[model samples]
Target: MLTNKGTLIPIGGNEDKGIEDNEQYTLEFIDDGILFHVVREAGGTDANIVVIPTASSIPVEVGENYLEAFSTLGCKNVTVLDIRSKEDSEKQASINLIKAANCIMFSGGDQSKITNKIGGTEIHDIIKYRYKNEKGFVVAGTSAGAMMMSQEMIAGGSATESFIKGAVKMYKGLGLVPGLIIDTHFIKRGRFGRISEAVAQFPQLIGIGLAEDTGMIIKNKRCRVIGSGMVIIFDGRRLKHNRHKILTEGTPMSLTGMRTHILSNSDSFHIEKKKVKILPIEAPFI
Candidate 1:
């Protein structure tokens, strides 16, 4: 097994150490928003992989130069989704790409742009179909890409005590992972307050804050922390007195019984069991 502190696990290797059986969805969280990499996370060896960078604002280069590195690693075939150039003409290309691959990767860019372009289109429909019907197709993304994986996504803004009508927004995510909200660049961006704001708004949900170069892999509803930085989990299922008499901007509030855990590389935490299980440093590969 190969591990990198901040970057993604190298592509094109024929190893199945950490992947789970019957796991059709491989979700990768990139250090940067909208930027991520995914190989065949499911199915037999030599699964086809497709990359979609529709969220990017700039033009993307496809073909040899674009996919040679990963293809050389082990990916049987690689294709890019250039949805911006010819929205109508490329529709078939996008659909064909999703239909042919066992893994799909969303590139980094604006979350809104990605969702707007591919969320309800034929390509999105095909991706959803493969995720549910296919046995081993995974959907992965980086920063913005990571945010799109959750049921609720952090639209924008910084950490602070102030509030705005739509300062923090929630949208329909891809729903590959449910009940959890993901935020990247956690520590480096000082986004705790923003996450806190989200928790305050939706007390029943779990807030996952991932530091730069850090990621959490979910299996059987349990999250395993990966990479060099830390994974901050805010569990507010037991919070009390959330309702305020006069709720307003910058008002003082107290949230009691909210649970938090600081997980380092290789540490595991269970959401439903409400327990944190630390793994041995020398544990064997999965």
Candidate 2:
């Protein structure tokens, strides 16, 4: 129920940065890509955008990557907040950058690092405050950054575990969106079973599995899919039979009445309503 006024863009891993390893193609693919949408939603290229690469092990390289990507999108006012430790989150410099920014973009690496370093910090509080109260404030993240948006964060899991019990590991997140449990790299990484167990654990929350290069723009409890891949939604609230609680760890589990939705770019989903809204605004949403 912690729906906010600002926008939340949680992308699956491997988003188009518009750059290659050998400096091949730049700005050619990312024109209408995820970063373009991020810039557009953050009030365009002039918006004060701050990229936090705290989750990344190589913060400098990741930070520079975002700088170039945003630069290619015509974003003139982008800054990288290289937060490495918990102490860095409390610094006046970091707080100032967060306070002045219209959008905060989190880079992917380790989701736990974001919560460990910045969770409950001053800037974290400020972001939640602005996101809850402000209309245009944007909080966007990719991969691990995407997973940290949910209150119930997926820390780590065994992809090889299949649909077995205890395959997914979860932890506390930023609590920006309490209604969702987000997972990144769904199709490529084969995270269907991982998120399925996660939904069985917290049946009240909706499970969102975002594929590579895909993302969702969430506002006012409504989510619209973006990017090139798919977004798998698992609704477990109407579950009839759940064998997760009784099953032992590592055992295969069965869950009945777990509703699923496979949505692509331009498709829409109303979170509270649990209904899909396809393209064409003139037609019936449900």
Candidate 3:
């Protein structure tokens, strides 16, 4: 049982961008207006936010992007931690920044890079400790960052090839949250088959698919959907299937009795109870 009192924001890739008069990005991605939400959750504008761009190939560029975004959102003490190697992750200065941060944001990129470079380092340990012990600490990540928030993560696989047994590679992640697997770029990328197969493989874990521009805000036992798109839940707890016929390489596996739920913005889901509360729709009176 994981009991982290802090908040986790896992966003799908390619969030909507706010445009300026000069046809440039306003630095606000219309991630259901989540940048503001993050500010609020991290104890308002004076919050100390450290952005980690380790997952990105172009760390400097990605780091700048977040620095600008948070700055535009009026967050005063936002800084980017340019961690390239395990040594950088272990630095006392890096660890100090994490310890002082009200929020830690992981930028989108290759999740393996994040786990390899930062995992088990002093920075990672401090993050885990603060997230569990601090009341309002926040951990936010997008795309690959979002994918690595669980105990088990999708390393790589195309949706078309995922039906084949052992096609998708699963890897150990940050383990900030347990018993869950998160997949980003869900609807736009057509990742249903990929996430479905993941659930079939590990029926005990819940499979969550986050569509682009959408995300989930998870606390201890509940998650609230945020953004314009939807959150797909593939529950395999009641699943029934025959695996003997499909264990051979290249053969497509079959699964049955898996339950699924689609949640839109403002909807809430109870993690422990596996329950969903849909927000009431608004309509004009006749």
Candidate 4:
């Protein structure tokens, strides 16, 4: 959507839920934390928030976690829409809730479950439509949910098989951001080789590797980093002497001149411009 007016917050797994009542963690939650940003972006505490836990195997528990998290943020109008199957996505009540939502947050789980259930349904279409046409609309996701935002999604991969031809597996995603391929828990999960192979396979698309408890707020082609960890950018647009294409499956591969950028909180990446705006050392914490 060239003129899309919505916002996408794709979080890496294990974001602070503000559940700990301890003083220090609570203070962290209050001051410019990731969820705080989400609430602020979705029109404050009064925003009509819908939590979709369809991707989780334990939807009930995950849904409740979000309800509590939002409550801690002083958000009262939160509803969990547990869409377990395709039939659930077609429910009129589900559709109504989605339409009324100022923001929709998808919980972490299996990305395939979300696409299998909601990909072609009315709920999915409504989200896409509202995201493109409505200003201030927000769609947020974590882990598997984050990975589903791109057109070419990485379903699963092995970090141990570094540079191997068949190291990563790809799948069709929700197409929310067609130009990106998102991978979560990158730092902790040791997924550099996974995303590295993915970028080599599709040199045209940019690969985003989000570390746990970290995320990016993307709008108007600008991806701004947030949270406590790092975001690795693998820009394969300028790759030279690529060997992945010539190698057979399971064969070790290599590439030269594949650009990489490691960023932390407050740094911004301009998707179309292929430029990075790093935060200065003296800037105040946002």
Best model per lDDT: 2
True lDDT of residue 19, candidate 1: 51
Off by over 4 Å in 1: 1-37, 40-45, 59-69, 85-90, 160-167, 244-246, 250-253, 284-286
Q: Name the lDDT of candidate 1.
A: 0.59
Candidate 4 lands at a TM-score of: 0.93
**Cα lDDT, model 2, residue 108:** 82
lDDT of 1 by residue, 1-286 (tens): 1111111121110111245421122223222211222342434236666666665554253222236445545555667656663374236766777778776766555676767666667776666666555545667565676777766777776465454333466677765555677777788767776776677677777888877666665555567766667788888788775653356654656566777888777787765676788777788522
RMSD of each: 8.9, 3.1, 3.5, 3.4
Clashing pairs in 4: none
Top model by TM-score, which number?
4
Model-by-model lDDT, in order? 0.59, 0.87, 0.82, 0.86
lDDT digits (tens) for residues 1-286 of candidate 2: 6568899999887644434732222221254488888888999989999999888877887778778888877889999999888899999999999999999999888999999999999988999999999999999998899999999999999887869888888999998998899999899889889999999999999999999878999999999988888899999999999988888997888889999999988898998888997777665322
Clashes of each: 15, 0, 0, 0
lDDT (tens digit, per residue) of candidate 4 on 164-239: 8998988888888888999998988899899988999899999999998788999888999998889999999999
Best first by lDDT, ranked: 2, 4, 3, 1
For candidate 2, the clash count comes to 0
Comparing 1 and 2 on TM-score, the stronger one? 2
lDDT for 240 (candidate 2): 96
Clashes of 4: 0
**lDDT against true structure, model 2:** 0.87
TM-score of each prediction? 0.75, 0.92, 0.92, 0.93
